[model samples]
Target chain A: MTPALAVRGATKRFGAVLALDGVDLAVFPGEVLALLGDNGAGKSTLIKCISGVHRLDSGSIEMGGVAVTMGSPAAARALGIETVYQDLALFDNLDPVANFYAGREIAGPRWLPRGLRLLRRRDMSRATGELLTRLQVGIADPHATVGLMSGGQRQAIAVARAAAFASKVVILDEPTAALGLRESRRVLDLILRLREEGHAVIVISHAMDHVIEIADRAAVLRRGRKVGEMRPTPDNRQAIVSLIVGGDS
Target chain B: MTTGQAERAAPLSPATGTGRTRLAALAQRHGAALVLVLVVLLGSLTFGSSFTGAGNLGAIALDASYLLLVATGMTFVILSGGIDLSVGSVLALSGVLAAYGSRWGTAGAVLLPLAVCGLIGLVNGLLIGRARLAPFVVTLATLLFARGLAFAVTQEGNQVYIIPADLALTRIGQANVLGVGVPVLIALAVFVAAGVVLNRTRFGLRVFAAGNGDGHAAELMGLPVARIRVRVYVLSSLLAGLAGVLIAAQTTSGLPTLGEGRELEAIAAVVIGGTLLTGGAGSLGGTLAGVLLLKVIQNLINQVGTLSSAYQQVVSGTFLVLVVLVQATLARRRRQ
Candidate 1:
């Protein structure tokens, strides 16, 4: 099967700082690729380039074997790339259903027959409910404002939105960094479920356990360059940490 | 670890507490409108014959009708986390243009202001949204520019153009359908349309999202955040222009000084309507109630007849302060 997302020779610079230097990455469908790095290790810059938040200084990205150039975030989304940032980027005043359907509304004309032109509230609610259920999210009401949700539930909703919309790749930046243990586990399970459903997932995380728990392959970054890649099996944590910090395996 | 994982994986209860919370949130969101309605009813009962009288009610509605139009447009601007200080000056300028255009025909009278004021809004939106300028400062500059244009067109406040009597544009401001003033009816229509667009459409969703954050994420989500911002200002200016034309028609003339302080009134109504001045959460219904509530208070003050009409500004200013204080308090509590 084709890799869901591929980045080659990606470089990014902000002012005088070279945030990412000649980084290359590939995320295969049905796989979770964890991007691990310490502070200022260029994880964010790499992901920004992939998600079209920032244009790469020099690099190319391909989605499902097609060369893709992301001029804007919308351009990236058109090619089935979705990013759930650390903030979750949800409207607090709006309910889950509203947030889920924010930009991607199902619209019809006012003069059209009752069900034709208007947003089908019932359909939206039902679809949202089903999506939440599949993710094992504990959101009982799809109409609950996201602001009222706990941090973990909000993360779940964000993840669910990306999974629902993105047909190819989902980039999650520190999804569970702020959550409690129970919530973090739920997010991890959700990540696993995404991979099982044949979506490419790139998880940017600092937590070793989170990476080991859900990631199939781990890529470490140190000082803006890819240090090494390792299979995140149970026994590989120490070696991975050594490579990340000490610079050689 | 496996046992712990199994225990943790046990399906959690789906948001069982969400129903009650949802109801509470709805009430909180609409609380201001409910309060305004109750205050109106109480004021009518307390004022007895004066408040309930048709003449008094009509006067209140008529006065509110134009402000309602301006406020409706401002609602979109404020909801998108931007301000349009130019609305007041735009109102004055549009009124002058409408009066001038009334010489040709009613269509010219109506369409001219819309085109001009909408251009002003479009400029404001482009500068703030696309150029990434601060909304407050950009609109403030436009406000001055619009005011200067108004003064220049009226020859430094020396000219007052009288609208022709036979012009249909005058009828929109003067005539009544079913005993309701046409301006009020138009305002009501605009309000209804605004409410539907804000609550039931994709564009409305994007507005809410843009308001909620720095707008970058919404842009990334394939939303045309800049375009939406531009459209919001255009809608705002169009409404202001419409209201200006109605005012000119009602008076049969346009005064360069007519809408000098109206922007404050419009902003007050929007804020009192339960929209956060900081942006991202507001309603057209709340704004309607807010306009009515302000008008009712002004009407009551007039019925007292002893108090000066200037107290209207004082009362509105006080209400604004109180509502903002309440909002800040609520926001602080939520944060904590």
Candidate 2:
């Protein structure tokens, strides 16, 4: 089957340093792809290129088999490519529903009267509550401010933010970086939920254990090159780590 | 606010707080309104019926009208985590422009100041929002620039353009409805409109998000961050311009120093209204209450008969500092 999202010959550079050298990757729907790499291994650069943060010097990204330039972040979002960065990009002072629908908030008339559109509060809140519950994320109040949530809860919301609108791909960068053990497990569950719902999820994580727990496929990068691809099972964790570190051919 | 504070507060967004914490948050949000109520009660008891008298209350409302107008715009700008220091100068410039335009008729008088002041605000917005300059620094520069332009127009403060009492402009500013001053009515209208726009509209959510969310993240979310920033500044300046026209009509002359330091007063009102100076969390409701509270206090001081008028600033400054300190402590607790 054609991949939900595909990247081919993705080459990026910062001055003289090659951040991503002809890196090719793809993910099918209903599958989790974990990007495994050590620091400065072109993981974030690849994500940025795919998510439209930076223009690729030489590469092409496709959503559902159509070549997309992704000229801007908005363009990427329009193509159903949502990236939840490590920071989560949420407004702490606002409620969960507000953060979940910050930019693409449900407003009146079904035809937004531009900036003058009024929000449909009940609709947004109901949608948010349902999304959280579907992932089994324990957020009891949709009106509660984001600043009052736990790490795991925040991660869940960020995942939901990406997955809810993402018809093509959801990219998560370092989702579990700040989460605790239970929170990390919750995030893993959320990833599986997204995959089960037939969304393509790409998680960039340093935690090999997490990648092993949820990822259907693992792609390791070393020195900006695609080094290895494997199905990370309990026994193959050591082999994945070795590939990530460029330990052997 | 720092990104660190924002990140730390992020996970805590779903605040299922205890009753006590909820009460504290409520108090923090509506503290300005509560204080306004308490002050009104005390003033009424102290001055007896005079404090609540229609005549006395009417005067206070009228006095607060110009301030309320300016504070309405300030509320939006602040909600986006920005400051507009040029408001005072823009008010002065607008007054001068209106007085000058009065010769042509009411339309000219009203539209000229709005046009010029709106242009100034647009420039302020572009500079700070699109150019990515420091809001404080950019607005401070504009304050000087606007003041200079106002003086240049007035021939170094020597020329005072006068508005004849019979003119349409004067009538609009000077006339009353139901025994209330026209400015008061206009201010009330502005408050209603602004309250709706700030709370119920999609643009309003963007203002809060821009102030409260990670800037990069907000951009990725498809919010027109630069455009929103520019619009808030524009709104603030336009409102200040309108306030100037009304005030000029009341005085019947454009005084170069008409609204000197008025921007600070407006900022003080916004802060006391429970709007965070750092942006992200605020309401126009709190701003109205803050303006009333300050005006009422000044009125009470006037009634004191023994105290000097200078005490007005003293009290205002003290309230500003106290409110800020309380907010700082609360924010710290939330971060922790």
Of the candidates shown, which would achieve the greatest TM-score relative to the real structure? 2
How well is each residue in B1-336 modelled by candidate 2, as lDDT tens digits? Answer: 121211112221323466656655666667898999899999988999788899999899898999999999998999888999999999999999999999998888899999999999999999988999989999999899989989999999998888888998898888889899999999889878887677767887788888874366677777889999999999999999999999998888887787899999999998998888988877777788788888998999999989999999999999999999988887777666
Which window of 10 residues has the lowest lDDT sum in candidate 1 chain B? B5-14
> Whose DockQ is greatest here?
2
Error of 1 at A87 (Å): 1.9
**Model 1: residues >4 Å from true position, as ranges?**
A109-117, B1-28
Considering only chain B, what TM-score does candidate 2 achieve?
0.93
Model 1 per-residue lDDT tens digits across residues B1-336: 111111110011111123444343344355566777787788778888788888778888999999999998898898888888989999999999988888778888888878999899989989988898998899899899988988888899888888998887776689988778888988888887776667656666677778875775576576788988998998888888888898999998888887888888899988887778877776676777788888888888777788999997788788888888776766665544
Q: Could you tell me which 10 consecutive residues in candidate 1 chain A have the lowest summed lDDT? A: A113-122
TM-score of candidate 1 to 2 decimals: 0.93
Interface RMSD values for all candidates: 7.6, 4.4
